[model samples]
Target: MGSGTPSFLGLLCALLTLRPGSGFYLPGLAPVSFCPAGSSSSDCQVNIQLFVNRLDSIESVLPYEYDFFDFCKDDQEKRPSENLGQVLFGERIETSPYKFSFMKTETCAKVCTKSYDVSKQEERTKLEFLKKGMQLNYQHHWIVDNMPVTWCYTVEDNQKYCNPGFPIGCYVDGNGHPKDACVINVSFNEKNTFYVFNHVDITITYHSGEGEGWTGARLVARLYLLGVLKKVPFQYLWDYILVSMPHTNIQWFSIMNSLVIVLFLSGMVAMIMLRTLHKDIARYNQVDQEEAQEESGWKQVHGDVFRPPRNGMVLSVFLGQGAQIFIMTFITLFLACLGFLSPANRGALMTCAVVLWVLLGTPAGYVSARMYKTFGGEKWKTNVLLTALLCPGIIFADFFVMNLILWVEGSSAAIPFGTLVAVLALWFGISVPLTFVGAYFGFKKQAIEHPVRTNQIPRQIPEQSFFTKPLPGIIMGGILPFGCIFIQLFFILNSIWSHQMYYMFGFLFLVFIILVITCSEATVLLCYFHLCAEDYHWWWRSFLTSSFTAFYLLVYAVHYFFSKLQIIGAASTILYFGYTMIMVLIFFLFTGTIGFFACFWFVSKIYSVVKVD
Candidate 1:
């Protein structure tokens, strides 16, 4: 990698290393000044050191160390300690050869020139690797004073967008087809040749501490290479690049569109609760001794409606896991919205998520044990074990398979054996015990009291129409909820695959709230209509209704892979789907749990208020 900043990711690296500001400064967060090499002490000169991170290509999931690609490595290679999140994300940070002093004007000063003799097989291989890096658009991430080294340029409407990393080089095929970087310069037009960005001129800007009380200044640095080139033309590195910014109008319109649907769904639910249910209850209660009740409706099956569903144990386990996922997602989003996980904080997002999930075992076990007890289950041991192990096991297995692929490819993204062991220790040593403690308390507390009692013998129900069949209703139930989030989903997937900045947490949190409301209302509405048709087997069906939204999500992911992205290679395809499956599973649990609880509450409230003889 080269000399520059990595925005938030760099901030995280700085937080860990905490070494640079050797001068008398404001703890670890201050910006140290720089000056020309011959400056006196009165000039307040600061010696600046630039740090380089991992080199990554968007077309490939694998990232490599800066030194791996035969770039100019530091004479004294000093690697800083990495945190769990940094390690997991494959951020390999090390000192770079580029040095600067504040206000030091650097022109065509030569860096180490690299050469490869094509006749030597080893050198040919190295050259080929460098070309491959350019072909796939590998980037060098550099950090300066805890800020990303941004390359800012004007786009449509004269708006400027800054990119965090710069490319290694540019290439053109034998047919004269060129990448975007190749078209910028005429000298790079040769066929089947790699044009390296060897020479760079970086500009660093900083806010003055003139009026401020602080002696050190906060840096606002940018790098632009216009007039600087290598004395030997062929050997150079990281510099100029640009990409257009996402339009705000479309994103806002999407949010507004989702809001309108949510308003409509909310009105429908309000009408059902305030008007239809109110009249239904009053009318049913007023039925006298002489007038016989209809044996074909919901009231006739109150006894069997409360019966435990098939695979009660499995249902409880799912509920428990869903609870954990729901809590994890909510808290993570809330933290992001509050700027704790902003682009300035780097890998705080992943670090926060992993830590929270490990600590949330209590809620999972508690919800599972309570539900199982309410189902009149006697096997508490099995219930607790399933709650703690089942879903987590599936996730770990999937993760392990993906990690194996990374390992086989020798990607830096591979988790070290030590980190993997640490994760397992956290799971079994901490989370499992916490889950058991929650389950014990859950069991000690009395089982939830149902409003209606279960009958010794289950009652037979009548046939359902095409409209009211469980499959049709469940299928229909997911449409509205999916509609509310599909547009947002597009942006989210784009961020992941394209490596774009995603700091739109406020809108995201709002959409999250809307999604939850839409899921609940849709499930409740469907449950109500089914009960009117005398279907008392509402337990598992209610959960499946909202959970099917995740299926739509999976379908959309497949469509996105084909339509929106140009991702090639079997490894990339496998990695994409593997991660997508994990997301889908978590979403299934989260949405399904939401629908089930809402339906359960609705069923209990209706049966409890009406006169059930």
Candidate 2:
């Protein structure tokens, strides 16, 4: 044990050296200014303090592991480490009051002076004006846990800049270029006593570009806490700046429109299930034998109702994959709730989920192989391998295509080549082998025997009414679950595309639970009706019922792209659908499996308890 300790420590050191950003650190970019003790001049020591609280796990089901950066370190290139700034509250100092202010430089003055002329000519414009004497551009953002903090930017000092609010507190001063002279003040309200002395990380990004209008430059700052700060005291001064901006009524309207559509679909499904369908089922079943015999539809196929579904091996494979998806989703959301996958962790959530899913392939294979055996499937090896590779391969291929497009477009969202290779290794090396092992065990088990025997002759299905048909019912079944999520999906999309933070896993988990219950109940209810009508073909229909939500999701994604997003071009559109297909495919499996099992149980119960001729 003692000998191993040194080796473990060596490994830890190496890991830390390799991944500096993975560990806890104060929020925001390193500061350009630092105040030494005994500095008499206030210009050199503007006190800056930050308070971050409300730390809770976004996920309700997973353990808290700060090791969320496991998937991000694929391509390791050592670039010149630019000084982000000085760390006021590093691991070395536990308790410290820090002051940070930008220094006056010639370049800073020149950048600010040029902006002053533009502001003077346009008095009506509320841009961040810099005088010939200003030196630094300062911007700050205050985010309340999971909420969005909106910002805008400008160009000055040959740099891109942004302010937290209007009338930018940051400006270019007398310097010919940009300098770190701006000071930002921060403090906590009286109610924010729970967090103190805890280090919060902050990042400030600068961008320079020339697009629409006068050369564009912008600087933006983000802040986050490293640990929980319960009941701590801190104070600092804040400079309030104002600026003119366009109202975002259109954006809000688009969100509202999506909500309305979701609500309308939900209401229709609810009405059909709760009142009309329920009453119809009871009334139809209460009819006398002669009348019931005369009435024919799904009831004609009653004798073959217990016949085993075809292609059970494929279905089992799907279920296995669905189980993996379900678990992955559950754990991801649970961790997000805990703040481990907070916006500050960029790509950490995806990395964590993929890693978890890969590790979980054993269960997927085990479940699929067991089910295939129960269905009397002979090709255990093929079933297991396909279960492991087929669906995941499709998704990965689609994702790779999208990544290629992103790479071409120089989009920030593209996954790197090394990460892609890591993904492949995870799928083929770990998940696939585990799946085969699971299938081996599953093939050894006995086939499941139905309580009611299947008839030799096929039962003829009667013509279904428009509402009773599979297409309409399946389409209708998805509306309720989608309603529960469409509102949440809006925020998720915003986070993914608009570069906003999403930390509301609590609400998301609830919605997920609601969706599960809704899908199960809707599928079971529909299956029961068709069964009573004597239809034995409920197998595929049941699966399709809940899986239909994927179509709705695809439709909504298209609508969102067209109306809500500013993205352009054929490649962007193709990339969007390529990714959307992965999401839809996963959803199809999850909901379809839920419906299948629920209906399966319902059919088994009804048939086992009924009196048969």
Candidate 3:
């Protein structure tokens, strides 16, 4: 096939697979190895191993790696596959003893049993931790063939809630309230003792070769571990796969909605540059000196427009952090879109982001120092320190506070002191040095040249209309950008709060692109209007205008919490808002920088083209 033909074919394939009611797996899906629960198949030699991830509680902020729990170890020292993100997230997936081959069956067989004597101090300590995990409702995350092993349970009447991992056990209180995974079984009613699940009934289901284009049986079912036989009749389900996958129609709607906003913004920006600005430039160049004196609009404020803002240091630092975050998010999302950071790889997403942010500190410091120098600041040390520490310190402080809460509650989600130290080391050792390097280079380079010269005396702006007022303009500027993202935001929130797997990063990546364009165009358009209105304070206005989108995100999150989430309790609420605040701040920086740069470019381009004496 020709190069163009392959590209066309790939596009066609993607479109076909994304159609509603289509096959669960994409076309040309690579076959994964699988064996029956008890039997081996010669067709595929890939050993099916159960890999365990960190144990986490929804109520907590810390997550413990699989090794933290003293459970059955792998027969060999072989560690399961993991990506960079997974490693950073402390996912320690090792091979499990329970192995299977294709087309096998075993009926309620005993995998292993643990009988711990409480008299022994070492064993008792381990048991105590295990019991604490049960009390805190920390869940196990098991993966087989890169697919999560789901534990399906009934909740909300007939609605079935299938968790990717089941708890090791549950604690029943004196009040007879079955907590965590114990609700699934009445036999777990022993008041104080941990009813550990010593055994599991494994079932493997696969699509046979009889399916249209498939050559061999492909595993379609997520491995499920039924802790107790008394819970329900022994039955395994593969039907949930079709029901659980995100609906393609909803994705298309989101894409279409974003496209409309993008197209509209594109048209408005094009009109301003091509028709409005073109004519203004032509008129200014042709008009006599007598006529020029009467024209006191954007042209009149040219000298003061590039005047440094009051808090140039702070703005430069924010822009630097924003640039770092922007690049990190873009690369992370793009990798996710390409399936490099798929949900199957535990913690890979966060791992990649953290690693990227650390490595990209150079750009962060460079942007800050360069902008600070442009603002005629000589304090390079202060500029670089703020660039490296300001935003990151705030985030770390918030995270540490959250972690402290988790520790106080004895939740498994708290980060260990060792891990915390390691994180600090990465930040200070790697990221801090990189920022200094970037700032050094940036300072060594000359400050950016503005197209128009600035006057020593600042211009006085006329009283603005309500629509052109700073607050109103900033508020209005964010609406379009927020509109483009609200749909995608729903899924992101669902992934975080509702514990749903997010795999539609392709859609997310597309939405991110749309958001950037929407933010840029919206800010540029608003900046143009303000400039034309004789407002020379476009510096801070442009940044605030796009950054206000974060406020809408906060609003929508509040709406999502009250409307969609069943989350209750002060701890959960506090943690939710705390994390949301961190996200909002980062987003503020990211979007604000985009708007600032866009407006800067627009101002420079327009001024350079017009005839200025």
Whole-model lDDT values for every prediction = 0.76, 0.51, 0.75
TM-score for candidate 3, please give it: 0.79
Candidate 1 residue 522 Cα shift, in angstroms, is: 1.2
CA lDDT of 580 in candidate 3? 91
Clashes of each: 15, 72, 12
lDDT: which is higher, 1 or 3? Answer: 1
Give residue 79's lDDT in candidate 1 (0 to 100): 88
lDDT of 1 by residue, 544-594 (tens): 999999999999999998888767678878988998999999999999999
Q: Residue 441 of model 2: what lDDT? A: 69
Best by lDDT: 1
Worst 10 residues of 3 by lDDT: 10-19
Best by TM-score: 1
Residues 1-613 of candidate 3: C-alpha lDDT, one tens digit per residue: 1111111110000000101121244322344643334444565443555566667665443566666667765557477565555543445666665655444444543444455566778866766777766777777777666666666656676665555566666777766677766776666675554565555545555555555454445666544444452443221222364365444578789889989989999999999999988998889999986898689778888789889887899999999999999999999998887777766555868988999999999999999999999988898999999999999999999988877776676544566797789889999999999999999999999999998899998888999999988999999999999999998899888877666567778889999999999999999999999999999898889999999999999999999888887555677677788889999999999999999999988998899887767
